[model samples]
Target: MVLLLFDFFFHPFVPDVLSLWHQEFDFYTLLLSVVYGGIIEEIMMRWGMMTLLVWLFWKVAARKKQVPPYAVFWTAILVSSLVFAVGHYSVTALETEITTPVLVRMVILNGFGGVVFGWLYWKKNLETAMAAHICTHLTMQAVLVISTILS
Candidate 1:
């Protein structure tokens, strides 16, 4: 996975990234993250927010067209991803101070996840995005487990 690659390649130089991701991980938290991050987030973000944006954009920009333009979809994806990235600031701020590096990290990483999920939702369905989100969490958890085992 991309995250694993980031960890594998950059972890030696930037070990703080691992710490920045999560301070604690247990079975319950992992389950909760998968459920909430995967199912709930996809529902709210892709299914709800992105869909809403697409509808609005389609209505305003391409009302007569049967299918929305690619630009509309990209606009919706970018906006929704922006919201998703900013939304993460709340949790990070609650945990610790939101420094410039933290802000950049969350924006790039979470925004990237949002875009991927949004693309899946647009191309496939809500379930596809949900599955991808779940897989992402599982992969991250697997990385954590592997690192814990190694160290």
Candidate 2:
């Protein structure tokens, strides 16, 4: 609930976010985003990368004969989230047509979203965090569709 509000309200003030949403506003686009963005994105970012990092960390801990606790779990979330943010920045860099202002807004929005996902992981668990992330993407797509219909 809080995260949804953050995504909605913060987007307008952040320039390109609302613009990006508007750009993606359409029935076909919304459907594609739900399938690709909502599911595939979360799978790659949270489940794929983050899960791999956690596994590697576990292997290291096992080699050292030390069992990591909750702190280690939280640290893993933070590290993975930072990596995700960096990846997002790289994507922005690759976009030749993206303006400086739009790039800045994208970085901020993606980074903020990553942070929220990390916090959710810490608060609940990986499953909950992934659900929240997916929800955000799905909700964004829905908002785009609804707004297009209204306007």
Candidate 3:
């Protein structure tokens, strides 16, 4: 809900890096983004990277325990989310200037969503996290389409 409101209100003030609808809206790109962003990102960030980070922490830091501690789990989520945010910037590096402000904005805005999805993946399941991501993309695409039509 907060994320939705953030998109509704503050999105225009932010850089296009954080905006959902970037280029001219095409159904194919929208569909592709929703599907790819939902599935592949979650698989990479949550299932693969986060799981590995947690397991590594468990192995090195908490060798006596069967599972990682809560602190380690949260560290994994945060680190993985930071990696996710960094990945976004890397993809767009050629187009945009990598200023401090832009980097901060990307980290905070996208990283917040990453943390939410990571938490959902940790607490609920991967499917739930993917659903949230898909819904987010779908909602943004719907808003863009409606606004375009209305305009």
RMSD of 3: 2.6
The numbered model that scores best in TM-score is: 1
Q: In angstroms, how far off is 1's CA in candidate 1? A: 2.4
Give per-candidate clash totals: 0, 0, 0
Candidate 2 accuracy as lDDT? 0.63
- Tens-place lDDT per residue, model 1, 6-106, is 44544344336345243345999799989999999999999999999999999999999999999999999999999998999887676657676667766
Deviating ranges (above 4 Å) for candidate 2: 1-21, 58-67, 89-101, 118-127, 149-151
Q: Where is the poorest 10-residue window by lDDT in model 3?
A: 15-24
Q: Quickly count the clashes in candidate 2.
A: 0
Whole-model Cα lDDT of every candidate shown, in order: 0.83, 0.63, 0.81
Residue pairs of candidate 3 with colliding backbone atoms:
none
Using all chains and alpha carbons, the TM-scores for the candidates as numbered come to 0.88, 0.61, 0.82
